[model samples]
Target: MTSSFAPDSLVLNRKLPLWYQVSQSLRASILGRSPDASLRLPTEEQLAGHFGVSVLTMRQALKELEEEGLITRHRRRGTFIDPAARRASPVRLLGSIDAIVAQQSGEHTTILGHGPEPVPGDLAAYFPQCPQVVTYRRLRRDGENGEPTNWAHNTVRPEVAERIDLADLERWPMTKVLRDAVGVDIGRITDTVEARLADPVTAELLQVPLLSPILHYTGIAYDGAGQVVDVARIHYRGDRFAFSVTVEAR
Candidate 1:
């Protein structure tokens, strides 16, 4: 490994179970010593070699780590370290800054952007024919270095923007802006979540290895009228996010 390895934290002489010892050492390297919070976890094969163990044994240790909420695995991407900032969710996250922030505590806000790109055909299905609104994109992260954690892209109708000041958004979250400015109280939301491979652009921005997996969410927002008003698509670093939801079984 690079100079980021915390070799001092590792003790080859430890009497702990082999798997346990190897797991702790790997965790320390991935989370403790990496220069960047966005650094991706090493491949399992690499870990196995580092510990001089069979891949199966290395996997067992990684499995335990995943169960402990320390790492997440993506279909196309390998395992990743989940950031500890997100709090539990109130309901299914349908892709809103407030909803995401409810599961997190830190400075969060949207940056106003100028763009009226025609809504993609896939996303257009979520809204009716109308004047496409200006969209906003925000990259959110916490702690020192401002390591970008996730990118949130939101499309809002002109009516909503007309009543809200873009300047205020830089300081306050989108929900607070809507509720306080436009008198819209968000009651609930619905969304679809999926695992996706990182395109070259996303990987570069996130400082993650290209081809790594990222969490993808695409959905629409409905006001009290139950009419969809906005459509959003967001991608998050898979290694930096772990999702847990409670579902009822009938």
Candidate 2:
């Protein structure tokens, strides 16, 4: 490892199985210690001592990681992180939210619920011809540490809504899901991020305390033909995320 291979506090959560918690802790720890994917994990005996767990428990955690395809164990060489776990740069991710989420290790989205709903008047103005929309309400959590990160609500125009599969939404990012379902290319994405305190419902869904600070984001996407493709509102846990922008000097 770079400097340390110690497990984070994530490994101490007693609510989950010990091995699972250890696995999540290790997954998050990998990116820090092996930014280049060249580091080999410490042996099981050492890791067990470091984490205050038995060798068998450590092996179970390693097995969980292996099953997730995040690590490879060799008979003589020890365990190494899969090269693909390396995260992309921040500027690269700004091109598309979906692209960034896809590249994040142990990031996953679950559809808490979905149904037909009327498009809000402001969002509806973007689609004069569509009167109603289908909505998907989802929660995004860190796959590694099992922390709730965001609560997102997405509404699609009637035409494209009919083709969407909730399953696909869970598996793919929003942009790709829209493109594949509509068979059209996305031309533009516009979004704004602001800070706000979480409301009761939002706090409950995000598992944050009421009145906790949150990053509220809203966006609208369009197709090449200039038709509104989708509208979304997302509430992210402010403490868990950080945003950086690259400024160029003239």
Overall lDDT per candidate, in order of appearance: 0.61, 0.70
Give the count of colliding residue pairs in each prediction: 1, 0
Candidate 2 CA-lDDT value? 0.70
TM-score of each: 0.58, 0.58
Candidate 1 residue spans exceeding 4 A from truth: 1-101, 104-112, 185-187, 248-250
Q: How does residue 48 of candidate 1 score in lDDT?
A: 80
Clashing pairs in 2: none
Candidate 1: clashing residue pairs, number: 1
Candidate 2 lDDT over residue span 1-250, tens digit each: 3453444454365655677657656765664342433557789998878777789999999998898787899998898778666442221225565654353222778888888877678776886876678888888777735877787788887778788888887776677777765575788777777867689989898886566557687777788888877887877765454345544575
Q: Give the Cα RMSD of candidate 1.
A: 12.0
